[model samples]
Target: MEQAELTALLTAQGLRMVDEIGPLATTGEVAAAVSRLRGAGHSPDLVAAVVGQAHLRTRAAAKFGPFADRMLFTRAGLEQATRLEIAARHAARFRDAGLTRVADLGCGIGGDALGFAGIGLDVVAVDADETTAALAAYNLAPFGEAATVRHGLAEDVDLAGVDAVWLDPARRTAGHSETSRTRPEDWSPSLDWVFDLAARMPVGVKLGPGLDRGLIPDDVEAQWISVDGSTIELVLWSGALRRDGVRRSALVVRTGAAHEITAASDADDEPVRELGAFVHEPEGAVIRARLIGDVARELQAGMLGEGIAYLTSDAALTSPFVQSFRVREAMPLKVPTINAALRWNGIGTLEIKKRGVDVDPAQFRRKLTLKGDASATLILTRVGEGKAAQRLALLVDRV
Candidate 1:
């Protein structure tokens, strides 16, 4: 934002425009005021931060009602906040390896740095944006000397040979939305750069969960993490992957609870279990890691059809990788027959599960005219080209 416009926003937020004061104020009070200012013109960062403030305000206003004024800005409200689950897993993994000191490259909003401090690790957090870096310092002040924030690029930062280097490259450009996908080449600390960093110290790179699995370098162990049942981000570890073989993992985080399912390594020689009566489908991370075969073997289940992402058996099995369901009924390998079976089951809430089918769920659900209080998961899949089959699945509660 321009100097005059910034001054006007500061004034609107109750900050006096001092003759000697600069356009961007570093004082905490002025910064906090800028967070609440509303106006016509705004930079993308300002707009994004303000929207984050609104989201925070909504939650604060709901809980405190009129007393929300007491609610202050948390580092999470800042633009660089990483999802809590992603940060926690990194902290846990790093700490378990006895790495007490860490450098958080691209430490936007100091979220990962905060996670490091929360786990009692020392952190040197760096960000390219001056405003974000300043705010990160402000937010990290409460850590009482545990966290350090700097403004710079990853390549320029002094590594000093720390235990691990945590890098969350800017997947999108400064003004882009979180959903906006960017190729690895577009990233600031490019994939090649990250690999270079790994050559020096163990490096962890945060990626989108939807990232193409093939693009992940063989030397980097990829991990897919989720929070509250939604997959959030993928993490890639170089230097460590070759030694650990823990290539892929699914992590679930919730208040007072945490669940992690790691990929089976070469040393984990447990034989694959036989196909069971019912099959369980694993999370995206599990499937991407090609661990489905291992899961099927673990549950003693067989693939339903050729190349399907589903397991089949007659008995119920409990596994964290995927939801377990009992087979209520089976129908002939025909669309009409499957549609008829759905109606007979009195299922109104039809959750279509297809491994290899090309039919769209929305169209199939609309065509079926599903109706009732009964909730069931239906698998509309191929038994063969001319033949099709439908199986009603019984949803099991997560353990």
Candidate 2:
């Protein structure tokens, strides 16, 4: 958002009007709301700013819950902002480590800073963007002197007396709605500078889950976290923030519960074996952390194929780390063969799942003329090696 709009949106009158209007879900609804506000003698700029914020808050509710209403956000800030629940977890790491003060470098919209202040830690939240820093200062105003927002480069932030440093380097040049896959070297403050800082202090760096494993430092504890089924972020912990004997970890969060599996070293992979009665799809966090082998050992399962993430075991097992499915039928991967198998089983609706293959599930599912009342998951994956390699379709049911 531009400076003037931001100023207008954060005004007492704008906030009151936004709260009164509530959330506008559709373009038509927004237009209607705008007309009503305009008729009520609200200025055009005020209506536009408040309406936009109201819409963003509605969307932000998924990440911030009720706090979204009180919070101010930029389009990019809301997108990059850490979910409040996840931020609380980050705060706990520092609080448990006996750290009372933290430097939140690149603290967009003060999402993590709010968590730090909420846990009674003194926070110095820094953002490179002036407007974002202003919004952060406004959002964190409730904490009074305990939380402070600064507008500056992360690398230039003074860290004196800060017990811990939290760095979320800007990884994308575009807004949150756009793809933000940038090279490590392109990261603001750069991974080089961030690592150098980590070496000198207790540090926590948040990165994309898909970051190249080779770039990870050996001394830090790397944790991959997935909220629901989506792999969210990879957190690198250094010094006292790093858990004892934990080098790599996968934290899976579902509905109300969370499960974490940690390994001191990369877990050894179980040997590839023939297709079994049950197939387990390891959570995305586990796969990203390269700890799927540990999960396989826990389930007494073997890799579906070398270098493939899918696991198979004859025993029926259920774990929070993997989504287990029961294999009903296996067939050569072909449209005709899959259709025939589905027809034979009276399967009408199919949940197409694919790995280590190029086929688009949605496009491929459209080709099959399904009939009957049954529903089942169809897994497409390659098995075997070299000339013996062949794609197989596994009809499976949730265990």
Candidate 3:
């Protein structure tokens, strides 16, 4: 949305009209709502802005919950904003470290700023985009003096009184709706400048989970966070914010509970062993944090093969870091044999999972003719490497 439209949408009258009209789900509903609003004497620009915001707010509910109702968002800003639950955890780290004030550089729509302010930390939220800064001001209005929104370059922001810094570099091209991934070197404020600042003060840098490990600075604690089974982002904590004795960590956040596994250094890989009765798939965050070997050791499990993250053990083990599945049977990776075996087992529906293999699960599933009442999971993978490698299909059930 343009600055004028955003200004119009934030007006008291526009907000009331948006509330009265409520959320518009489908395109038909949005078009109808726009027609009705224009019929009621609202300008086309105002109607369009209100309707678009209503839809965005509904989508934002999944990320910000109740806070989304009153918040204004730009399409690209909302897409890159951190989830509220995860941002809260980030804020907790600052609060627990006794930090009283923080500078949130590159704060898009103030997602992390909201979390910091909610926990009583004064926030100076800065964004390079003017419209986004205005929206952030609107969203952070509830915090009053505790939150300050500024429109400027993150590198230009004055940090005289700030106790800590949280930086989320713009990793995508700047646009309201159309954006593409940008190379790490092209990041706004630049990683080189960010790390330079980190050396001077406590800082937390948010990056993609798949960032190259070699670029990570020594003495900084790198953490990978996963929410609801999906690995989200990697955070590098520096200076006083770095946790003692923890160099690498994986934080798993589920519906009602959260768990963390930390290590002083990367764990050694477990030895490859014969296929056991159970297979363990390490959580994505664990794998990203390079802590899959730690999980393997915890469960007394061994690697299925070199460079494979899968673990196997004779005994069924339970751990929050991994999802354990009971192995029913194994066979060579052949479609006809697997189809016949499925038919013999009365399996009608199949959940296909693959790793360390080239087979596309969707395309492979179509080749099988499913007919029966039972359902089962099929795992396709390579058990070894190079010339000695063997393709295997294992039918399993969740533990």
Model 2: CA > 4 A from native: 174-180
TM-score of each: 0.73, 0.96, 0.96
- What TM-score number comes out for model 1? 0.73
**What's the lDDT for all of these models?**
0.61, 0.90, 0.90
Give, for candidate 2, the lowest lDDT window spanning 10 residues.
174-183
Residue-pair clashes per candidate, as listed? Answer: 16, 0, 0
Instruction: Flag regions of model 3 displaced more than 4 Å.
Output: none
Question: Per-residue alpha-carbon lDDT of model 2 for 91-209, expressed as tens digits?
Answer: 99999999999999999999999999998999999999888898899899999999999999998877888999999999988453454668889989899999999998999999999
Query: How far off is residue 102 in model 3, in Å?
Result: 0.4
- Please report the candidate that would top TM-score against the real structure: 3
Tens-place lDDT per residue, model 3, 1-399, is 887788788889888877777777888988898888899998877897899889888889988999888888888989999999889889999999999899999999999999999999999999999888998998999999999999999999989989999999999998777799999999998999999999999999999999999999997999999888889899999998999999999999888479999999888888888789899989888998889888988888998876888899987677999888899889999999899889998899899988888999999999997989998899998786557768899999889
Model 1 over residues 1-399: C-alpha lDDT tens digits? 223332232333422222122222234644544554434445544444444433443444432344233222333333345644456657877888778888998887666777788789999999886656765676577787779888999989877757788998877666312335578789888877887777767877887788776677666677776555456678888764233757666665544366666664421222223333465666666665556666666676766655556666555566666667676666654566766766776767767777566767777666675677777777665432223443333332222
Range of the 10 consecutive residues with the lowest summed lDDT in candidate 1: 14-23
